[model samples]
Target: MLIFPAVKASSRLPATSNNLHPEKHKDLYAVTEQVIARAIPLWNLSLTPVRLPLVSNRIKFKCPEYDMYLEDMSDSEGPRREDAKMSTNEKSAEKNGSATCRTSSNRNLGILSLVSVPPHLEDQYPIEGPRELKPDNTVDIWREYEEDGLQIIAKLANIHLTPEKPEYEGGTWHVEGQLHICASAIYNYDSDNLTTSRVAFRQQSNVQRAELKMSYPQGDHDFLEEVFGCEQGGSGVQDLVTVDNPEGRLLTWPNILQHQVQPFNLVDSSKSGHRKIPALFLVV
Candidate 1:
């Protein structure tokens, strides 16, 4: 009979701390800052700064002209003072151009002049275009795949998105976030050849979340309905031609991915069957 009494569970349990989950507790600012830092160095290497020669700073001057005046004091008796004055006035009028007195500051002096760049300096620094990610550029990932018709190029650019607020209120709710994606493509349109040569700057975004809460206004939801229910058809041709009614277009990630594959596939198929495809290209 030495059995201990069964421990009764307490009605009230001790409250656990409301600490944030590790996965859920993301520092968005820190994440964004890291993304920027990683992105900037890659961009800087791609674009070289254009330099201009400095000009010399100098002062200029201008001068004014005046007529010479002579007084006839000794011969004042014959001609009188009035005649002398008249002569003086006549001489002053005969002067062709007024003399201009100019100081050094009056003349315009260019700040700097272009001088011959020293041979040593020229050798050290040469005129160049933007730093390009050459086919032979030494990037760990890029190099391995470059010859295999795969490439990655990145640049820095600004992006803007619509729907200022996070919530969907009156109008059709559209979620948008903008970011610049610097891209390089390895594909040829003509014979469907594959090689990395094309570079582009794109403004792209993702709609992470969307919801329709309430509707008091009639026209508020119209745009949303239209966006959600739009049909995918082009000039003159439809996927289903005979059908009077066309299916509404649905915006999804798969559709976007499918649209991007054509160009890539064209080049990929044309490449020599023997060449080894890089793992990164396969993942992308």
Candidate 2:
């Protein structure tokens, strides 16, 4: 399996593979890169990086006013301690924002709170807001979906893995909703006490056409299999890239390519772990 390198949040471009030889990959692009896209005009290139001087540094916790409910978000779980006074149920409740380190009943897990301080947005611009509307845009590919209306289907879910059931077997190769799904977005809100996990993508390739174009006379299409490192007999599944999924990360992609969730397990021997995600599918 090919592991992709980590890309920072500022990246807004197609990725070039280090593994691919420039000469060979460019030559294959004529036969393999079948999909070409038209430009869809977008607005607002500036006004980002909201570095407001007055409140940027002042905001410590997202909602400091609600500190009564939260213990403050931390990058990692602190040292696990035993709570002798608490019941077994209370101890296990640690997974749901519950804390064993609390000294008394004054503190409780804030995870269940319906409303709290919004996440601190210093320089980050979350795409969920209504910021990217193009008024003067010409007719584009998505114009059909936007003319009347379109709804985005969302699925809120979490996977819990314990010592008893530690492994999350990889998902099957499929699109988000088979046909109607145009785009999909997955937000990894929380992934605690788990090993590194990844999501993979593969796209259908024009095997017969590519073979005919590249090696019609010789009757030898070995390079199609060897160069791309894929078996040629079956349906052409061109492995694209595997994305490393981490906490607070948002991954979005068009639904034309099939994708799957890679398997993951708990990092610790006894501790329980879970990944909380909300997947959104856009159907036209």
Candidate 3:
């Protein structure tokens, strides 16, 4: 439902300078524009956007910074009066209970010995039965998000590997974390003189599924590597699959999985190598 610019790279272009080479900058921008035009379609193919109702995108909700809402409640005086009445009732009950406990003999010592539980803090908002959420009957988060739309955060990175530093150490395992990132599209548009690099996806899996299919000694739950293909301690992370990040390859996956780039070296160690990538992360 949101109509905006296709991409903001054009808006984010650096300003021209008098000392800058104008012709070279012109060609650079021309190429970048063309690449972006081509990449938009691939981004469309990357993931299907789901309309999720997130707390950040909630409409027209606010909190008064200086107890202004409390001031408004004071003007109404209804809830305050009720609270005053309830406190008086609690004091009266406590006094009566103390009087009865003092008058009791050794035969009623059992009742006196019983601990008195404090009144629940939620007595102010008491309700019949459970006034909590029922799992079977759920409330829809997206009640009326008609004007909402998916948000995208874009990233562009250029990496050059020279002969002295031919091997890329790769990236650590992580998830994209801007505004509830749900999907990602990584397009490595250009690679030269580099070996094939890959991105591996991994996540915590349900070990109980495999546990139910087999019989084992009670409390002997050391099947982390045997069943889930991962070890215990720091060496183990459950892997699902890996996708190649070669030149002009567009790889996409949901952000539910943690991802990391695998190590790669130069195809020709004598020469330099590089890769240019533009990634788009989708948020809901």
Candidate 4:
């Protein structure tokens, strides 16, 4: 009988090469490098330390006082607190008949109290009273936000940004680059954590789009925790860094850094809350 001996399944298995699972053997490092190439220029720019403060590149923090001041005076609204103190001062001034000017005693005025401090103390008041609160004149407030953004960017990029006068020629200073501004309003809704690790732009026919991502400074993580009230540590998902959304704060970062904003929910359903952000990108 020339019957062949029965062979075990293990012995019948064919020899396989190192790439047994070709699908799982993808070059992830190569893919990451290719993705990062999109942001190489900007990354280099952030590092290249151009000592001009001609533009702002920083993240602004929550200015509750500023917000309160703006909201109060918005639409020419009157202060809820009766300016009894101001009235008293005015009555005293009139009784004294000396154009009396006393410092503002209203604690609710926030940073607006600075207006009381005279520039020359020669009775030549620039901000005479609360009525002089013009939004345009509040450039100093905007400067605070600008400085905040610059500070964060300086720390991240390991560069010093000093205020420098722009080069002037002919009749105007020569400024290089286009200012790209984008504003987004976030209400009581959640958004997916979108990474701004790479620069992307697209245009087709009539449609045009550009996107930039900003992240808060690492030192502000605790502040984010307090604001977000996230009891849990780390992102629930692994292999990701947790950061709070810039949320009305002016934030700037190299396009190479990965960042994301956690979903936020309002504590009070009866009241409305919103986070509005306006970002500026300088493209040369």
Per-model TM-score, in order, reads 0.16, 0.47, 0.48, 0.20
Arrange candidates, best lDDT first: 3, 2, 4, 1
Measured with C-alpha atoms, the lDDT of residue 2 in candidate 2 is: 16
Residue 79's lDDT in candidate 3: 31
Give the alpha carbon lDDT tens digit for every residue of 1-284 in model 1.
Answer: 01112122101111221232324534522332233333323333322121112111111111112112223424542322232222343345446432212112211211111223332454433323222334344323333323342222212221112233212121221112112222221221122122222221221222112222222123333322332232223121111111111112111111111122111112344233111111001112
Where is the poorest 10-residue window by lDDT in model 3?
59-68
* Each prediction's whole-model lDDT (CA): 0.23, 0.50, 0.52, 0.27
Best by lDDT: 3
* Candidates 1 and 2, the one with greater TM-score: 2
Write model 2 residue lDDT over 101-210, tens digit each, in one string: 22223332223211112335423434233233344432233344333433445566789999999888978899875566666767787799988768999877676664
Give me the displacement of residue 124 in model 1, in angstroms.
4.1
What TM-score would you give candidate 2 relative to the actual structure? 0.47
- lDDT tens digits, residues 206-225, model 3? 65664554443344433334
For residues 154-234, what per-residue lDDT tens digits would candidate 4 score against the true structure?
011111111231111111212112242111111111212222112121111110110012122233233333322332354
lDDT for residue 134 in candidate 3, whole number 0-100? 36
Q: Number of clashing residue pairs in every model?
A: 26, 0, 0, 6
